[model samples]
Target: MPYLPARAVATLRLLFATLLLAPLAAQAQAEPDGDNSQSPYFSVHSDDPANDRLPLKSTQVRARVLGVIADVTVTQHYRNEGSRPLEAQYVFPASTRAAVYAMQVRIGERQLNASIREKQQAKQEYEAGKLAGKTSALLEQHRENVFQMNVANILPGDEVAVELHYTELLVPTDGVYRFVFPTVVGPRYNGALATGSGTAEPWIATPYQCTAATTDAVGAAAIDESAPVFDLQVQLATPTPVRELVSPSHAIDIDKGADNQSRVRLAAATTIANDRDFILDYRLAGDRIESGLLLSKGSEENFFLALVAPPKAAPSQLIVPREYLFVVDISGSMHGFPLDTAKVLLQRLLAGLRPSDRFNVMLFSGSSSLLAPDSQPANADNIARALTLLDTEMGSGGTELLPALRQALAVPGDQERARSFVVITDGFVTVERDAFELVRKHLDQANLFAFGIGSSVNRQLIEGLARAGQGEPFVVLDKASAAEQAERFRRMIDAPLLTHVQARFEGLDTYEVEPPALPDLFAQRPLVLFGKWRGEAKGRLLIEGQQAGGAYRVELPIRADQAQAENQALALLWARHRVASLTDQETLEGDFAYSQAILDLGLKYHLLTPYTSFVAVDEVVRTAPGTSPAATPQPLPLPQGVSPLAVSPLTVGAAVPSTPEPSTWAMLLIAALGGLLLHRRGPRGAGGTV
Candidate 1:
């Protein structure tokens, strides 16, 4: 027998323990796979279909557009079909820029308007009211673009309608205006399971429904059979004639009305699947851009929004060499339509590049790799090679976007040339703030454009990336628009509409502008400014910027006599913009002061936010506390065009699986072999030692 060293024995013990416990750990963390026979964690019984169905009954969206601002109303109907009185919670999505100000709950003939409260106080009040068997509702903000609504004490066969109202500014890019209504919240991949009891965000712990069939196929069938019904209508009024009205996401019928007004509604027999986003795009007739000011007076304060369109720059012939880096996501969430769309978009973008431009393609999943170590000229051969690389390397993996972005940003290019980075992805990862910070840090080095590709892309991530990188965000919902989006991108990158922008306010007291500093304007987008004003509004708003060869300026007169105090929405919209600005500053500075400011703004304005929530309660008790039904987690529809494989059973939070380095494995093997060698060599003999 041979003797082994102490370190060898310890290493062997650890190796055996790891090998034995890995399987158990995996089983404990295993996600639901829509299989009842194989899963031992939860039992699935053959029960009533009514009990298994989601409590959501119907959803209706109505919109009214006046000039560049839109007022939207969303109403959701919920019914308790089961025997027990249940508390229903539904997680939903909204536009990142939407300023939600009002919410109401309708029960039969009675309607209750929800009030804003601090998040903790609101939760306490709602919980107390629920335990008392009273009917109540609470709306909380989970993320900038995601919200959760909780309706409590809904008796069997009873129905409740929840209506939310919001306002948003519509800013067009390249003469095209788009309005999107998101229907679903995609499953998030959390790296770790939540522990401890907290009602701060109960929806985050909602269970995901998985099925043996593919998400697309099963989702479509489920939507056709049991999906909640939606009736969407929009009344659009433009200052100019509505030249073109199109719904690329759904089939909609548009009817022209009097005075540049039009009515739009979904076509007949079209099912509103919660999986995809509904988008409406329209172009105003003629090339003229409208620039004006909107004034709204509140009882306590006055707010104003100014819009200024820059003059188009004449075509220049300097033709400076440009470097473009394209970073594409091959993550599992982007396995199907998203990846295909990216391929087509990348091809179109590459084809649009000139021979003098330098380009590189980087594909990222669990790791990132470039088509070339250095950027190559956009020649035919290089473009062909890049296409081949994309085709061969396309596959599903984890989303490691931060590392890929770092890799792309690290690649040095000619300082004289304008460097641009284009990120194409479904934007499913949770590390959005990290990516934003990284881009902001390197923004001076390169401009980054984000192309969000999917039926329901993550708007917050895509928009935040662009804002941090001082670029524009483009959303491509379908394949038909890929070429058009690519062309838009080329035109935007060719030359900026306005650079070195500076705004001067003459004879008007203005403070706390939403965006303290203005970035260069790209494409045909108008310059929008929101701020608070005191004293008389009689002042000249002057906007000056640099164009191709010289400077340009525009001025607009503001008058206080035209201010209307009835428009209280302006105050809420201003608060929303201020909150957004503070959030961005929080990301950049990582300071508690910014968070405090945002919280104060949300509370004062009654806006739903991470720190503030809306809660309402009925004074009379409806049901006994002991007989209350359990809270049921609502299931979300899978985003359209996403495959089941992209959302594997264990994809909660879509956390990237940790992989050990090959060197570590090699070192472990070497240590084990050394231990065996030591054992074979045997212990030192007493006689040899003497």
Candidate 2:
């Protein structure tokens, strides 16, 4: 309540990163991340560092949006600025729904197309080529959205270009279509034993730039020329005329062409650094959605994608007595802007609850605490108490989400009432799969709704949590959108757009459908189905569901004559979806149960996955064994609004920050708490409401 504006809080905290990060970390005082978890370390410019050593120079992106599908090509350019032979490594991110199917590497006049293979096999190939002094590039998936690229054995003055080609299905929500291009992966909170972080996730140890922090109003006082620049252009062709075009994340120029076509590009001389996700949202000219069937006839397999729009949501006139639990995150990474925005969102959500509803609040950091022992009636007094408790919290410490989730699930609630949980966080932890498994197991107990609060949050974790919990995920990038998103959450909880969805294929030889069963639809988004068809594609696709307290049905005719060349991406998309589903199952079981299946799918579709990788090697040797080479990790710019503490202050040859030591921070907190207790006692004795 008595807090600075969220943006102001974020700006001040970000500007003081160098001075406050160490002391804050000391206060949070987490134990050693036992699972061999890696933390980013500060990079030293004096350690023989040169511009050339930062091999990654820039990234160029080109994308085309055709109706409900998007095809994107990203090229990473690395030029060895150092005089000796060296290898370069960079960690980045992509859309969680991206189906990366192709990769290519260019060395001078020679161009080599990469091949998909088993992950270990690809690693072996890259290592062999590195030892043989051949230039090579390897791409691997660390998380659903996180990826790593390693370009090895770059000789002096040599340049390398690695290109990734991917496609994603664009599903519209509430008539608005959004495309997200993640530039950098945010630092993750590696918990105890790091059991969930996959095998030696070295990408977490990358360097982060911390020197200069600024806001949009202040712009960048000075730009780092050596740092990578971002360039992107998107050609959008919709089925209907465009009613709106905008990008809330960046400055852009839109050139509207004839018949629902437009060209969008970064504003002239306005290219920015790769520090945050790029988002573009647009709406078509009409209230109706552009949803239909798409088909692809490949040499070996025929694919079909069906997009069925659900009916609109029903009115919420009757209130249901619900048991609600609000789980909040107050970790160090959410210290300022994210925390402030979360507060606003919680205020709107709790204040809007009906008096008949029962609710409780849980706040988590390196630990967690509840507002009350049990769920309390949504009265003014209880709501006020919860708000007061949240207002006193200062975001600090590591994100211990799994422990908090387990505790929430154990809380007892009324069996007669529908149980629902609202989890609000930036989703920066590494235990995503474990968390998903936990939610999936107790799904009968409660449906969890996740609100991702940050500029560039971990969408993979948030989306995964919702998917496993059989609920919905919402992202609020700023405080201004808090009320809007909160209202949407309330609306969704009132009723789903469609339920009990069943798809029937008549006369169509469909096999290997991505999801054997369909889940209820909560928004205005279309119901999507991907599968392969044998022989002719002649059939009727019938979908039946319940909508707005009434029976709803949709029927569409499918024909082989409708197959298009552009729809070839459907084959890759289907394979990717299958791999994703299998990966989730494997994670839920805490083992590699479906690794082989996923690997086979990746290889067959020429896509990338956790069990598979893309590797390109130039046969010509470029260096000799006698030459001493170095391995330099490309340093990334800290995500917008993220402080420096997101990474560790410890690194080879890096200067440790001068701040209160760990012991001093603990001692200081004890004294402050004691004094605060005494001060509150005095206020009560003076007949004041403390």
Candidate 3:
């Protein structure tokens, strides 16, 4: 966090091709655990040496979340080894219901957090009578959409195993069930899609494999591979057309039947090779919200199943009270455009604060300070004072985030009101775990929101912290993103339209479906949900909200396959917000299920996933003399200052290529050795040999 002098900054900028962005890794260190024999630590790495961090080996894990129950089992192996008992710290990417529950941690008899088992027992006993065939009103409240962990204490030479359990509520939704996972971004796993439907149970799973391409003399070459693709089969009660769109792969196949029914298939492709994530966008779209619902008719294990629905009335706005704390980093890194932009945004945020709302600003660097001595009702004088502080000489120093967070949490407010802390930073350090843990400790009262600045900041850290805080993380990719985020922030802070919202569907005994948890209603946006629906006839649909004083409920009429477009749009907006919020919370579900589907579709339709290659591999696999015989594999260019074992983003989702020894350097060294030997002998024999 040290701020380089102005001249130093300029000189460094001139000397390096890129600005002095944040370093991606932290130096390893040992800390004391209560147990002397066991100590555990966690670190992240990337194969991209340019990143300069420990590479995160690609892993496939199993995870699930439901009402009050959260579980994750990592099939991946741990590589840490030592003779003493090591404190294993599992890092959770976001906040979850597990935090409040006793998490059962098992790594071969070293039970770290067994209190989780007790919590589960208590939950089961608490709901023994009404547990079956019932959903809780507070169900969604317990569900965390993002999960990351840190384990402490482990013995040396012992194989590490991981299992976590907690509880959460699944909010019911009216829209299609959608899940997203990021394998990598923008490149390798580019433009992938998958689609299928089933009844009874819903699940999506994908197995990922990694590999590389073969080439010749030049440093560049085309990557090609052929592997077994997973099978994708879904049974439909009626004819339903499935369409997939993937990058590095494109297709258009239209089908029509004599019955006058029509189905359209679409796909696309891209050129960049990167270890990008696969995004799954699925929904049952039709002319209306009702009727067009398709139910699961195949095996009960299909991941997606739709059923008949109803119409939703237009939503009304309600007022929600808020207590906010703004945390700003005024380190030397912010001396340039970063600081200026932050000032403007702060001003906008202050302007949007209401007189009834409570707020404070905590600016940190080498030290932390508040805008005022205590929390103040937003007013002209206080707002002006906060802005004035921003204009003062802000110096750069080492980032001490813990103290700043402690100060922000110390701000007092009504516990019932929605509390929030917004952190703004360029995210340029390695204190990811400590900072996030601090936020986690005080998350019960305030939601943490983050606005990440800079082009090369560690998004994982920024987004991870926000997720842990049950807050939203905004990225300022540039001016455009900054402006857009500012506006979004303004809207979120304006007011809450509703609180503790709920939807109840009456009349329909033969139906089977689950909905997303109802979310906290925000005035800035509407609420939307996606879920499954089934069977005939329904009664009146009811929507309820808890206001500051009284409860509000509205009853709407039902239809078969038709959905109200206006209501659906509002729901879409709500859905987007909920997903973003879950991502920030790191409790959102992973995209593995959807990713598997995309990979399958990519393979069947020749699409590209981190695991699926879009380029034609048929010829490469059929290596014939006529066809370019697997061109003699050439060595990949080694990055300077990087080790041969470094993971390459290009190689993610594929097999690792064998590295060849440096041929030119080896030849030169050998030739030098031979000449030295000859010279030594000649010197010794000289005239005698002649």
Top candidate, metric TM-score: 2
Ranked by lDDT, the better of candidates 1 and 3 is 1
Q: What residue pairs clash in candidate 2, if any at all? A: 35-193, 35-194, 52-81
Ten-residue stretch with the least lDDT total in model 2: 651-660
What lDDT does model 2 reach? Answer: 0.80
TM-score, candidate 1, is: 0.85
Candidate 1, superposed: residue stretches over 4 Å from native: 1-52, 192-223, 626-628, 651-690
Return the number of clashes found in candidate 3.
Answer: 105
After superposing candidate 3, which stretches have Cα over 4 Å from the reference?
1-295, 301-323, 330-340, 355-358, 365-367, 376-385, 388-403, 414-419, 426-444, 454-473, 508-517, 523-541, 546-690
Where is model 3 poorest over a 10-residue stretch in terms of lDDT? 196-205
TM values, all candidates: 0.85, 0.89, 0.40
Q: Give per-residue lDDT, candidate 1, residue 471.
A: 92
Clashing pairs in 1: 188-653, 189-652, 189-653, 189-654, 190-652, 190-653
Candidate 3 residue-wise lDDT, 519-571, digit = tens: 45432222333343445435555667865445767665555444322322222
* Candidate rank order under lDDT: 2, 1, 3
How much does each candidate deviate from the true structure in C-alpha RMSD?
A: 11.2, 5.9, 19.3
Best by lDDT: 2
The sequence of per-residue lDDT tens digits that candidate 1 reaches over residues 1-690 is 545558666867788447433533453365444322111121122166445347788899999988778899999999988887788878889999889988999988889999988889999999988999989999998778989999998888889999999998888866778888888776543322231111223344444343333334213423344557878999999988988899887878889999999999988744445677889889999956788888877677888888898677668656778999999987656655777888889999999999999999999876788999989999999999999888764345556787789889999888878999999988866667767878998978988999998878889999999999999998887678899999989887888878899997998898888689999988788898988888887979999989886788999997777677757667777888888888787777765657677778887887877788899998878899645555765666667776443443432233222223323445665677676666556655732321
